[model samples]
Target: TETLTNRDNHNYDDVMDFYLMDNGPNVTGYVNKGFDVHLDDFYNNLTADKKSSFFLTALHESQHTMGLQHPFESGFDEWVHNSKIDSTGSSIMSYNERDFNGNNDLRIYDLAVLHYRYGVNPNARSGDDTYGFKNFEQNNADGGVYIWDGAGVDTFDASNEKDGNGVYVNLTAGSRIYRGGNTIPNWTNKHLGLQEINGS
Candidate 1:
């Protein structure tokens, strides 16, 4: 992937270019074979909460290069619904929002595809990490998140969340959890990582 600063004299032959421009309506960014990624200038116009930032847009577009498609585009709505997984809320590929506003990480479905394609990264988030409202907000993981920790003791602390009464706290991957008053996808390997789930 190439980040071109000089679009005036840039070459689009063998590299994936990421740049900003006024592409069209409702189009934030797009990718060509995972090599070329273009973000619309509208990204600069929207509020921070509404726009997932150019970094996330680039991440979404980059997934296209890996041959991933939107859940609706791939006709996976039935599965998505049956499984109780909101693609737009959990996957970056979707051009919609369901939960809080936007997500920062790869979410559940995106991780599934990535793990299938390149296997799981055993070193992701390898630290004494915590998952909760403040943690998610600090990281801009509003949409949802999938915790793939490699090592160290981890925790899922929702005790500080006042609206976490009916929140489901599961240790299995792909289960939905409540965060910021909204139920969203959040999975963690409890057996391998998280040792406790402190709920409200």
Candidate 2:
């Protein structure tokens, strides 16, 4: 921990977890500082959005490690990117408020950007091939019902009801699941069970 904070020519090349004293009130953390991977100190102050904010910042910084830049920021070939969602710009990369749906996630548009830039990465530690992204209901006015996970495009007919009234059984290819219904029992693969889906 002490070694990451003290950055220099010798240790700047290593992964770092830093504590920033000057980030904005809304800003929680950063992945890389001066090209060194770092996580900021802003995570400690996440009051209502603690869990969401933590993962959001971690993912944001990880994108940096993957050579991804904010859509609003400049990109390769010295091109400027205008990728902020006009409706609700609260993705992990943006300064807007981080959302807390089933999971605080990157915007659908941002995931597309990553796919466009680096292509799909299969065999994740969890979830789909697209960086462990899974289908969770997004509760925003933007009508963003999906998380644009690293996997290819997948859509389903479902509802956001906690009672499991609108759950979709059909999924597209590359959509790794963690849950399922009673009939579709596959524990190692599916994280959600059917009884839970029915709200029993």
Candidate 3:
């Protein structure tokens, strides 16, 4: 099916290194298959950090072979030029470098696109807003120490609360304060805690 061959037997050059080829194609210096990856001077000429950077570039280029076009490469030249540079920060096809300074980390939108395109999600939770926690559970209800419900005017009352700790108060919507298995009244918004308000 596919073969990865080095351009030359020498191991010290920083120019051309390896090439990939399918059965009927000519061998070349660039990676071919979407999965075939190579780090430029991966082991010799490049530093460890540079190796990682090239690896990410290979990953992005591989996506190109998978029938996906760069977001900026689409025919709308004006739109492409005018688009926010940060927009590409999360996209692999954004022509941006994949280093620490770059928004090198993938986002949820990237995962969704990958899922839709290749049936695989690379960074499934890339842009999750859960503060990296899988799920949240409430330990109190009413005015006790708990996540603030969006619509309430309650203060942290350590005297009436269990464990003698002050609660975190919230004034937005859908702040859930639970006790045992029951939910507190006035906090029944399905979108609660899910929708983030601007400047709030």
Candidate 4:
């Protein structure tokens, strides 16, 4: 995976997006965390009672990496907003973020795909992983993602890639993180990066 550059970015065949803490390639979108909208902003973007942006972003991008493009991105732009309000079509691959409804989860079909990819068959429905200060994220058909910080701190780094203490925790796709009794830190996708328009 090559590092992402402001002048060298395209959705196809791109695998990674790395940045510095400065005015570098700041990011906001999933699959690519910029200096401006990195991971911590994932949580910061949510409402008080509905703060699941981080987890959802993680899952969203994970789904993308798993070959599940946004419903519209699947060469089906006609389904973008065919109905009134937002209709995600009830698939995690849908862009209907408003449907997050605090329980934004991977649909059954998606889980089926992931299970097959991971060599594990899923049941009808594995239980729901609710969002709260716990910072729980879905791992696989079994366990979950865990992020632990000493000093009783419960926070992520400004970039949401590391712990507040500057330690890198393993956050892989198809997993979730939980901060039990810890200051879930703030991450930043807070930098400014220019977008590359077609034929620019």
Candidate 5:
């Protein structure tokens, strides 16, 4: 009979919350000066094509980190207007893919941008130097390359390049010389500022 009388009901609830604590103020002073480049597992195992692609990707990303922007990023018309330098045949920053589809080295405009950004390396290859296809078939197969020489009387020896298509050598500063072949890209090789060129 006493159990029939009920007391006032009471309820209790429990709640939990989480908050991320700030460690400290953000770091400063290295705004555009430093960057981290990350390559995934694919980089560890590269085929011939992948190697070229990896090289291009590394150069392209490094240029971005160094404050370089693609000409077509904003100025679409300008990129088309300056097709010479705004194309992949000339600039690595260019999105336009040309005959040099699998270019392994930096193009002319890429070299220009780097020089403009960091200034020329005055101490590069100051001694007498000779550049040529050590192994013609192998070099041609590997694709284009650029030779940067700094204040030296250099020579371009094409003795080993027995390609009957003929070799065109330009011994001027920042000019490219290439062999005539339907197989070779338009701008396949260049030796910047060479004093001598022989062995045709």
Candidate 6:
């Protein structure tokens, strides 16, 4: 297995997006082969609730090193939104809650995705198919909500609804949510909402 390292200051310069290599490369701030879960300003800028969502996302990305793609689905984009544990809400692989991170309620399908990627065949749906925090819900209000102090606004709720907190929502109907307002899309065409916190 490779170790993960941190590359916070290490610049890629003009490296391409994806590098084809038989073995993984080294990192700077994280352990080798280990996923470098960056806790940058972007992450800090997220609300406590959003922060938890991203935490779970990091876990999902870490699992990718084991070779897992988003779970299989039938529809092009609809598949992800449709594939739920029991049709209650979005799947860990779904776009709506892709930013959610509730370590306590890690899903079996998510675990199964990791298992399949790692080549470890655990029972398809083991004990308690129902796991994770069901109480955690994304704020669907309007305007902007507070994520972190120096990081600034993370998500924009265009819905105009109050998202539990006093802050208004900033997310628009067709617009995607991003951290630090970076336009680059992340996994599954979603945006990375965490920013690098200075002196962290």
Model 4 misses residue 36 by how many Å?
Answer: 17
Clashing pairs in 1: 16-35, 34-65
Stretches of candidate 2 off by over 4 Å are 1-27, 33-36, 41-51, 74-90, 98-103, 122-200
Best by TM-score: 1
Instruction: Give residue 157's error in model 3 in angstroms.
Output: 26
lDDT, candidate 6, 107-140, per-residue tens: 4344333322232323433333322112334331
Show model 4 residue runs off by greater than 4 Å: 1-27, 32-50, 82-89, 112-200
TM-score of 5: 0.44
Off by over 4 Å in 1: 1-15, 44-54, 75-77, 80-83, 125-200
Ranking by TM-score: 1, 5, 2, 3, 4, 6
Q: Report the C-alpha displacement of residue 56, candidate 2, in angstroms.
A: 1.3
Name model 3 segments beyond 4 Å from true.
1-43, 75-78, 85-87, 97-105, 120-200
The C-alpha RMSD of each candidate to the native structure, in angstroms, is 11.4, 14.6, 17.1, 18.6, 23.6, 19.3
lDDT of 6 at 172: 38
Global lDDT scores for all candidate models: 0.57, 0.42, 0.37, 0.39, 0.51, 0.33
Model 6, which residues run further than 4 Å from truth? 1-40, 72-81, 85-91, 98-105, 116-200
lDDT (Cα, tens digit) per residue for candidate 4, span 32-85: 432222344434446865555445666666666544555444234444564311
Ranking by lDDT: 1, 5, 2, 4, 3, 6
Count steric clashes of candidate 2.
Answer: 9
> On residues 53-84, what C-alpha lDDT tens digit does candidate 1 reach at each position?
66677888887765467665434534455323
Q: In candidate 3, what are the lDDT values of residues 71-99, reduced to their tens digit?
A: 55533244455433224443555654432
lDDT of 4 at 155: 37
Model 5: colliding residue pairs: none
TM-scores of the models, in the order given: 0.50, 0.38, 0.38, 0.36, 0.44, 0.31
